[model samples]
Target: MRFIRYVLRALNPKTAVTMDSRQVFRIRRCVVAGVIAVLVIAMVSCGVYGVKMHAQRAAQASQSATSTDKTTAKRQNSKKESSGKQSQKSQDNADTEDSVQAELKNQSASLTDDQRNEILAKAQQTARDNGHEPTQYTYCVAQKGDVGSLDDFANAVYRILNGERGWSRAGATFVQGADGNCDFNIVLSEARYMTTFSPDCSTEYSCRVDENVIINDDRWNGGTNDWLSAGGDMARYRVMVINHEVGHRLGHTDNETTCAGAGQLAPLMQEQSMHLDGCATNEYPLDGELWIK
Candidate 1:
């Protein structure tokens, strides 16, 4: 600024006349050079400031990108962890169900020929040893729908009915007569046909209407979920249902009785199909239930 003021003073007419033409020309040249140098310095300073601003902007952008990447990675890792936990829980539940199914499979195995024969012999001897004349009750086996293996079903009925722990203990013995020629009917029918016998009968369970001892084939094959869950097998379920339904034919009503206590045998007349109510599964009649008639 001082140099600019000095140049302005020198350009005045009086000052220029005092100085020689050469000095005047030199001052003029110096003034122009000084203005150009000032402009150059200002431009250089602006350029440096621009460069610094650009560098700061680039650094900020890079930091933002890095922060976004970290956030996304954290979310992905969290999702993977949640999915892994869900898969593990599902696998554990499936494993437990499979174990229970395997146990039921092992328990459902039928008796061998020798075993059947031995049990039948003992049951017959027990019936005879009761020392009372066996009250004869002729019955017939019939089917409403395709009940699968008529012989197998008939044989099971015969064995269970005449078993030592059956109604035989009460001097009641069942005999299968010719078709349509019997005192009572033990009908093995499909689930859909169960309600046809009477409105009181249901597809979910067995029922006895008059002389018809209706057995639901579904229950015969699959058994009840309640019974199976209570550690009961298909074979024992068959025994219980047969006795339960036949007990109705022998003048017993749907008692819907509960267990005497925990760990005690459930009453054969109890609705073991629905729930055990803290009782163990039982297949035969108790002493009090033997004389239903």
Candidate 2:
């Protein structure tokens, strides 16, 4: 510092020839002092700048460390979630497999002999009752020998129980044809009709279970069976068959619709008079239980 100040002062003649030799020396001293002040200011500025740069670096490092910790925590959490989902999926699959296995073990294809009979009997009874029985429902089949019996019976059956109240509100009106013939008519397509089994099952057929049995015609064209073939039951033919079929309306299947048929035959919901294979409403004891309460 002294060397610098001396060089600066030596160049100034005015400074060398001061008011006093002492003053000249003072000028040189002042220059030296100024130089020292400048040096001191530079050192202080450098120290302050170094401190600020170090603080900035430290803050950056801290931020980076914090960011790294957050990244690691997120990765661990994602891994844990993935593991939990895999475990849950495996458990659900196991449950589904167990359910399928359990279901597979419960069913068999073969039916018991009793069960077969039950099915047949149930079908016959259901079909007949659904076709023939009305509370006071009647089907007009004239004397057994009449060829037009089917027509008359169809009429009565339709008139009484073809619409809604075939069983409750339905009633049959028997009308006699010119040649001692009969016909049963059905007004509604949905009305039930009665006929004998196809020898595969000898007796019951059809039920008039609905309250709305309606007849739209004076002729009996639907519901054909063999009872009309054998001329036998006489006037009872109409009533007996009606009764047997009605038994189904009261809810018994083939096991129940019985009266009597050819050769000491038990009448079921059979066109009773012709084959003596069945009975009419009068043949079966009228049960109050048969009426819908």
Candidate 3:
């Protein structure tokens, strides 16, 4: 600025005349060069500032992206954890069920052969001892749709029941096909030496059936077959399932008369969820409920 002022002063008419036209021309050229230099410096400063701002913006964008990635990763981790927990819970439930089923299998197994024979013998003694027959009774067979085949299955049951070790068919008989006045139709759906029912003790029960399925998906580990099937586990379940359903026909019902959500029937009925009653719980007794005067 000072140089420009000085050049203007030198270009004045008085100085121009004192120094002549050549000196005046030189002073004006110097002033113009100074102005161009100032412009170049200003432009450089502006460019540098723009570059700095751009770099700052890029850094900010990178930070924002990093934060978003972390958030997304956290959500994914949480979901995986939740899924893992659910899997663990399901496995635990299965294990608990398995334990219960194992116990039932053991109890059911003990009911066959020698043990069962002993119980049957006791039952006959009780009937003879009590000497009171049910009203209009029949060996009503609650037919199972899938006992493999009915004729063969029924014949097998007849052979087994007849050979019951302790049981005597003294007053007992097999009434086949419903005569007009059939009281009940009982079929040996599955004749496993299953459980020893009370000797001469008769229990009558009734229950409401929930979702009945053709396929057996019971809770018991032994499934329907292990209970009293003829073929194998599957076949055993088929027979057991039939026996249970037929057991209901024998006058069994849900044990809990007014339970909340069917407290499940006893084993002989559905899941074989129950065990055969001991002699004490049986309805029939050698001595009557009330003394016979």
Q: Using TM-score as the measure, which candidate wins? A: 1
For all candidates in order, the CA lDDT equals 0.82, 0.42, 0.40
In angstroms, what RMSD does candidate 3 have relative to the true structure? Answer: 13.2
lDDT per residue as tens, model 1, 1-293? 98776677678878677767887789988878988999999999999999999999999999999899999999998999999999999999788668756644544345576765675566556666775566767889999998776777876787788778888776677666775889899999999999899998899999899889999999988998999989887778888999998988776666556689999999888888988889999988887676746
- In candidate 3, clashing pairs total 27
Per-residue lDDT of 1-293 in model 3, one digit per residue for the tens?
Answer: 98666676776777566665777788777767878889988999999998999998998998888888889888998988898999899998688657655643443342345654464455445435545331212343343233344444444333333322211222232233444345444432222211222222112221223211112223222442223322223333334444334334434343412211233222333223243222111211111121111
TM-score of each: 0.58, 0.31, 0.37
- In terms of lDDT, which candidate is stronger, 1 or 2? 1
List ranges where model 2 is wrong by over 4 Å. Answer: 1-7, 10-21, 101-293
Candidate 3 Cα outliers beyond 4 Å, as residue runs: 1-33, 93-104, 110-293
Pick the lDDT winner: 1
lDDT of 3 at 197: 26
lDDT of 2 at 189: 24
Q: Return whichever of 2 and 3 wins on TM-score.
A: 3
TM-score of 1: 0.58
